[model samples]
Target: MAKPPARLAASPASVTPPLGAKPVPFLAAVGLGLALRFLVPIPAGITVQAWTLLSIFVSTIAGLVLEPLPVGAWAFLSVSTAIATKTLTFPAAFCAFTNDVIWLIVVSFFFARGFEKTGLGQRVATLFVKLFGKSTLGLAYGLSVAEALIAPAMPSTTARAGGIFMPIINSLSLSAGSKPNDPSRKKLGAFLVQSQLQGSVNSSAMFLTAAAQNLLCMKLAAEMGASIVPALCGLLLTPLLMYKLFPPEIKDTPEAPKLADERLVAMGPMSRDERIMLGTMAAAVCLWVAGDMLGISAVTTAMLGLCVLLGSGVLQWRECLAYPAAWDTLFWFAVLVGMSGQLNNLGVITHFASQVGNQLVAANLGWPAVFGLLNVAYYALHYMFASQTAHVGALYSAFLAMMLATGVPPVIAALSLGFMSNLFGSITHFGSGQAAVYYGAGYLTLKEVFSYGALMSVVNLTLWGVVGGAWWKVLGLF
Candidate 1:
């Protein structure tokens, strides 16, 4: 009954407890908003309300980055400021509470809860290990397959990687004599850790529901008359790419499948809850895939699945309320979406885009060349960010708007940036929630994280840019 690592002790969906606020960062955040509101002259084309809202939005993003308060607190503050300042009316400020994309993400969190509660997620990972755990590389692929299979229902990448897979990965590495901080660390732990971390990033990019920001990206893309669907090209290539870039010390892991088999046997057959959970997940996926044809929205499909789980006793209503991550996500996501949508409506985004686009236009580059440059710039900028949701909230709309203004095709501009929102999470130890989980395990050194992260970033950009671009063309998305 030893305690788990501090990072792993809390519920997977629980918010990190706030350290007492830093007075300097807190003042800096407020100062930034005030400076933008008063000191900076409003551009001629932007309305006063738009200027006011922009100031609040910028401050909120700064608060997120600086951590003057918890993310949910910052979001709540932003909504209150907007309403109090008369920048947005009550309904206008809270309209995104009913947003379908926001609900879809919230519901998906419950889906993840069912997976964790019923132990179905663990069962799936072990089954894959039993099938493909004969070698280190094979084990990485097996875990990647499991990651992709469950990603759509799991919005929190941290929950998927940290809750289900990390424990099992720790067991496998230990049994193979690959303890962290020991000479044998590189034998299996280092390679598997990095491989699965990158694999999670790839899976996140492949599905709109895999990470919360993805649904935000989708809603933003839809504003520009472009749509994003599940992507398979990158998910199919991640394992092989990671194997080449970060080769494991132990080429063969003979004990992995045996370990997996033993664990599976110990768990016995899938219980009633697991079986019902599995069926609900399957029906949800099918409905989501054909949702447009069936005239059902993705959110509607997710709600239906949640209802089924509730009715079948797989998940109780009290448990859903106790799930802090879902409610926290709902609050922050709705506020950000509300403000972002209002910015679009007020032409703040368009005005900002035209200002930026004019400079790029002056370079006299073709739209293709502009796209390449902006794409790289956007992906590389993740080093400055610690949260994907913050980056998207602060920059995604503006960048997408600039691309459109510069005459990039709608689908290419919108969806390319949308996917890159998740892909860039591969770049840093602090890049996303799951990145922190893997890095916190004390397995990989700082040098290893940076070096492999950079390499994987390059590979992802190339694969998605060339291969994904070609695939989209064939599908007539462009």
Candidate 2:
């Protein structure tokens, strides 16, 4: 037999060979999981069928966290395994894509493609720059306003923040005589970069169609039969509060406004494409906001808007596929939603909730008190998570289930968890999908982003808990 190459003593300790998995960590995780599965006793009414399904769900979730493969791949594996093991029929396994909410996400992404392909997103951002780009702070607010304006039409926060806004903001920074790693960075670039990143989070939280994860949370909430109305109040209040709390140290700047004005003059009037897109966007938002009363679902409204954009020749079929984020989101998100729905069907959510519920009852906790604790803990836990989608996948269903089991209103639990998913995005530099784009600009240091994020997280959460509670009380969320 040919002699096997000797495995080099695994480095001088911490370092390991590249281009492969870390066997120790992967083995540890899988072994720990196996131990839990075979050793732990099952409770009454929770069958081995439930156990198998839960194991598949958890293993895929671990695959998500460890990231041994891409998230979409893991999601695919979750569904495929469920079918292969007969834990779910083929129809049930693939049923998530057929969900109305899943279509809402897909159609929302098509709108995003329209926004990008039509140059409407850039045109709108420039208008904000022209109007409010008078001072550095004004420019900041303008960018915030621009983001919020386009948020309803674009569901991917990364697409909105990274693809649409970052290019504009980057140029603004360069034009204002600011360069990355240069001493002049703090003059205008640093402040704008940080403010806009925060603003992106605000906008993402504000609209249901603002972020991919937001749609995912909504779909999961709907699966649990929960309404998302309470989230609206928190979303509405985030932008202004972020501006007030995280004000730039360099408050006044004449250069930013001048630069914005020059850019506006160069761009000239809105093109035919921009005008049509604006009208289409307005119609979509009107229908979305009035959906419940009109008996027209949000998904229907989005599809209608997308069709007009395509039919009007403003957006082409090839252009829709060209935007990779939209397609990537549609595929991965559909699978995740399906897996979540399957787990719920298998009694996984109820079983997990009952376990947590028993602990709360044993501790003599009331709903109001527990509610506050849960929200705070949920927000704080973001420190341990890097991806909002991963965080939602792991905790949202369980947390919502536990809250529901505790006699909390489904709306209260659903909206709090849903909004908090975005709120937590403000707590770390790596908190959300778009965090890296802003952080990589080299304007703000990691420590600055983290500290500022932490401070503002508390502020936003308090605003929601205190002011939002009052708003909800007035609206009878109680």
Candidate 3:
């Protein structure tokens, strides 16, 4: 396993990884999965389902083991195997590129790049620091609030949090006295980093527009004939109600980092790039929100945004062309969505759902009991997820099928899974993209990360399980 970085300064000087490390764990997982599927006696029609689940599990385990491979690389390997094995055809695998949600993410990436290049994101962060950096708790609250407010408008969490706020978090840690090997300083840094991760993960679940995965959930639910709006309110309100669950001390020792605040502020007045990109993004969002009424797909709105971005020179062709995340995202997402289509095509999802549904019904569990049990199962299932997309792609279908078989409304099931995806990511340091970003920063030790993640798990599970469930029932979703 690669050693975790000792502090933020230890990050590779460049964004790319050094040469000679093994490809990411996703590759190994795919290889092993393919080998197992080929050599094992699993049913022919069910082979894809087995391999998909195992690949996800192996990649996640590899992440926790501290493997040096990039997360996206692992995702690629898994998708490749599914294609090579003929479990999913190339056209089907490549279809995720055309997914409305994927296009939305791609367009958002361009906007985030503009934010970074034009200094708009920095100015926003600095403005927040000025407003809330007076105390430690205030800084924590500021970071969390900043992410929550921005999340609704940003489709890609990595682009929004990683691209925009990651540097800010790094600078904030330095300001908080997070020096290399200083236990006290490191502890502070860990708390702040985890705070930001949790805040982003939790708050992003609130709105349909908050995260791409949430949209995937809604889209999937729509395909299944369930409503998603009811679930949205639960995710939004539960996080606010659970704010007190985090350790109380993040608020105690407040002190703003003067240097970071000034640097962020000094970047000053929006540039041409910022205005054009921001305006384009805002316009795209307004169109997306009104898409249902206008009878246009959200993907069409995103493509419209992409066209303006490319045609207007807000971002050069080179800059727009340079983003590999879109391709990487499409590669894996395509495979999984394809695999899902296959499973549904083969009636495998329906079968699995029927089996699980029968078990629940036989046990005579009521709706609340069923909800609790399924969520617990969903939470445990995160031990197998390194990527949120991988989790949603691999598990949501099966869970939804079972929920439908059990007579649970599709909206309730979809919303529960949506909230669970974010909550489960809070269970470990490498549980989601944002968590990995913080973990890679190196201010937090493995033990510290685990401790904080586990602490937040209690709060998240309780809030979502108890309050979220009640909210669902009160809203007549149950």
Best by lDDT: 1
TM-score of 1: 0.64
* TM-score pick, better of 2 and 3: 3
Whole-model lDDT for model 1 versus the true structure?
A: 0.73
- Best first by lDDT, ranked: 1, 2, 3
Q: How displaced is residue 336 in candidate 2, in Å?
A: 1.5
In candidate 2, which residue ranges exceed 4 Å CA deviation? 1-33, 132-254, 365-478
Tens digits of per-residue lDDT for model 1 on 392-478?
A: 876787788778777898877878887888888766655666665566555776567777888878787887777776767777766
Clashes of each: 0, 0, 7
Which residue pairs of candidate 3 clash?
26-74, 135-254, 135-255, 136-253, 136-254, 137-250, 137-251
Q: How much does candidate 2 score in TM-score?
A: 0.61
Q: What is the per-residue lDDT of model 3 for residues 357-441, given as tens digits with 9 covering 90 to 100?
A: 5687678676667766776676666654445666677678777776665667777777778778766766665455555445545
Per-residue error at 371 for model 2, in Å?
5.1
Worst 10 residues of 1 by lDDT: 222-231
